[model samples]
Target chain A: MRITELFNDGQFVVTAEVGPPKGIDCSHVVKEAKEYLSGIHAVNVTDNQSSVMRMGSLPVCVAMKNAGLTPILQLTCRDRNRIALQSELLGAAMLGIDNILCLTGDHTRMGDHPGAKPVFDLDSVSLLHTVSQLEKGVDLAGNELVGEAPKFAKGAVVSPCSDSVDAQLAKMERKVMAGAEYFQTQAVFDSEKFISFMEKAKQFGKPVQLGVIIPKSAGMCKFMNNNVAGVHVPQHMIDALAADKERAKAGITSVEIAAQIIKECRPYCQGLHIMALGWEDKVPELIKLAGL
Target chain B: MLITELKSKEILDSLTQGKVFIINCHGCKEVSFPEKEAEEFEKALGDKVTGILTTDYVCNIDNLPLRLEKHAAAIEAADTVLVLSCGVGVQTVAEHLPGKRVCAACDTYALPGHQGVTPLEHECDQCGQCYLNITGGTCPITACSKSLVNGQCGGAKNGMCEVDPTMECGWERIMRKLKQVDRLDVLKCPIQLRQYNK
Candidate 1:
């Protein structure tokens, strides 16, 4: 079933992300998702996330689907031009995939191959618009498709913890106008700020899934504070993680913090999107601890 | 104004291997030319440098031909002509001196100001569709790293941009400006999808 159906049915949707391996063999990630993420509504397969080269999200998503897991295909405008992007959308539909999260991917300079040419022919908003157009059986050039048009439960991302709330809201409104049925925010750490952002975001009338990133270590929190855009790991959480010097107990501490954040944000959002960046083993515990 | 920085010494060295004529433009109003750096580079080049001709406003198409004519001897003697200026200056030199192998000795980046005129704290990308009327004087296309038209991308920290921490977030600046003018409601008017064709 499409994620939108879950949202419409008033079920508190739960999703997680799985980064495809850089090599062709994705059995490890696929097996990991099937084993650990069975309770979640769907899994998002990132497309060359952080601009690093990896196995395409499409094939990995197919792998996930073959494994009896629902996969949300994450599409970015950084690698492909309009033609390639449209073609990929059609291909995903042909393969029975229905969910897409459109993003204006991280700049190429931030990736492994800085010399690679970035093809951001369409930003996130335009790409969402393109998705809506394709659903109507027309291509970007106004040409009709030869076969049945592809349909998708379109989604987009927003950053609620940004310094500028109004600017983020304005963009969220645009995303809604461009046909984003749902939104998964950037990793949010501050509950009070998120509550306030949700208050304003409620006006958009779209289901917003709060993004929760599992903080693996205190050093990881600090790194995210400095490097990750729109992600601010509060000092208290850092101190909490830092207090657990014993590496054996770090996973327990991480899950506890993630659960606490989920509980705090549960009242405001319609769903939860956990990004356990390589720490997928702890997700089952996180879900249980959060009482999901 | 166009902010320019000198290319790395290694790149300059590779490009300036042959006898080269240098044409440096000091015409921009407020843009700082890397004169000291260029001087050091020329000194390092020593015998490889055929000649140096410093001119003003090399981007001026009408005056460029006369300026190149005056330096014809030095330019003819050199195998390569190195133009130290913004892209416009280098292109002008290349167009005028098509026979010579012309190369740019600097990389140019945009500043928050009009090109070839008085430098201000704001810039216009000339994206044709002006958003200033709604943005309250701050240009999101020029100010934001991703050039997001609707608003902030949620990557800002303490008003600094996610792409470049040194720079202020464009949407933050726009919001502050809008608030100061009591026009924050303008951001809620409608969805704005940038027309790339425009």
Candidate 2:
């Protein structure tokens, strides 16, 4: 079923994110998507995530769709301007890739090619409005479409960890007004904070999927705590994993933490967005452990 | 108001290999002015400084030209014109003294409020879309690192910013203030996406 339909049916939707490979090969992604097909509602294909150069998200979503899995094409404004973004959206829709997640991607300075020029001509909010305009069979310049307009299940990313909760709420409302049907949040490690965010999001009357990233190792947990923005790794969770000397045990402990968050956040959020973070093969195990 | 810190002597020495004229700004002292640093610049530069000119308000575009013209002879004699003021003051000097090797000696920080005076504890990015009325005068644009206008990012561990541990989460302050003012219904209004151009 389409992701939107799953939301409408009140089904607990589960989506997982996968970054495309650095090259054109899709065999690994196909394998991952195949594993995700049974347990998750949709697979969100990430754009050149973290400003790192990767295979484009569009073809990967197409590959996933061909593999009998619903694919949500994640688009960012870091690399494209309004014209290119509009054209790509139309192309993706024409190719039957319906679900699109709009994000204001990380600045290029954070990526592999630090010298690369950033094209932030439109942010995620602007992209959503442009997509809504396209859905009306018109372009941003008020130009009419030659044929049928593309129907899109628009989605956006939110971070409930923001210091400014009201500003975050205000931006969320704007995205909904601009045509975002659902929101997939940043990785959430705290349940109480997620519950409070949901109380405010519930007023928006839209589906929000709590983002969960499985920590692979104690070092990884510490790294995320130090580097990643809008990610909070509690001391106890890190300590629990740090106590495990072996890598295998550490991985299991991380999965257990994800399971705990899933169990706790399930009541407040309509969905769970598991970001495998290169541990795609382990997502099913995490899902099973969470009893989703 | 902009806060400026004088460039390191190593950088200044590298930039100005020859004689240079210094122009200091005594503008907007209510916020901050580089008084001690300018005094040290004179002492450090010694004979390298051909001349020094101080303007009451270098940011005053109208009166600045006449003030700078008064030092035209000394400025023309020097090989380079080094400005020890905020970016605005530097630009004003550069605008008046065209065709000169003009460079800044200070790094200007982001301005706080409308007059650019008083570096505020709380800032507004002036993203062209203001939600202050609903947010109880708090601006999410500057308070939140991600500039989220909807809800918190859920990364805060204990009422602090996930990105910066020492900082309070912008949303937490907003929520508390909203409750205090009893204006929680503002969250119900479906704010339209920012028209950035507007």
Tens digit of lDDT per residue, candidate 1, span A1-292? 6899999999899999999999989999999999899889999999999889999999999999999999999999889988999999999999999999999888787789988887667788888989999999999889999888889999999998876677788778888988999999999888988999999999989999999998888988888887777788889988888886674255878888889999999999999999999888899999999999
Off by over 4 Å in 2: A247-250, B1-198
In order, what lDDT does every prediction score?
0.82, 0.76
**Top TM-score model:** 1
Please tell me how candidate 2 rates in CAPRI terms. incorrect
DockQ of each candidate, alpha-carbon based: 0.31, 0.16
Model 1, B110-135: lDDT tens digits are 55666675223445454544455455
Q: Count the backbone clashes (under 3 Å) in each candidate.
A: 1, 32
Candidate 1 CAPRI category: acceptable
TM-score of 2: 0.66
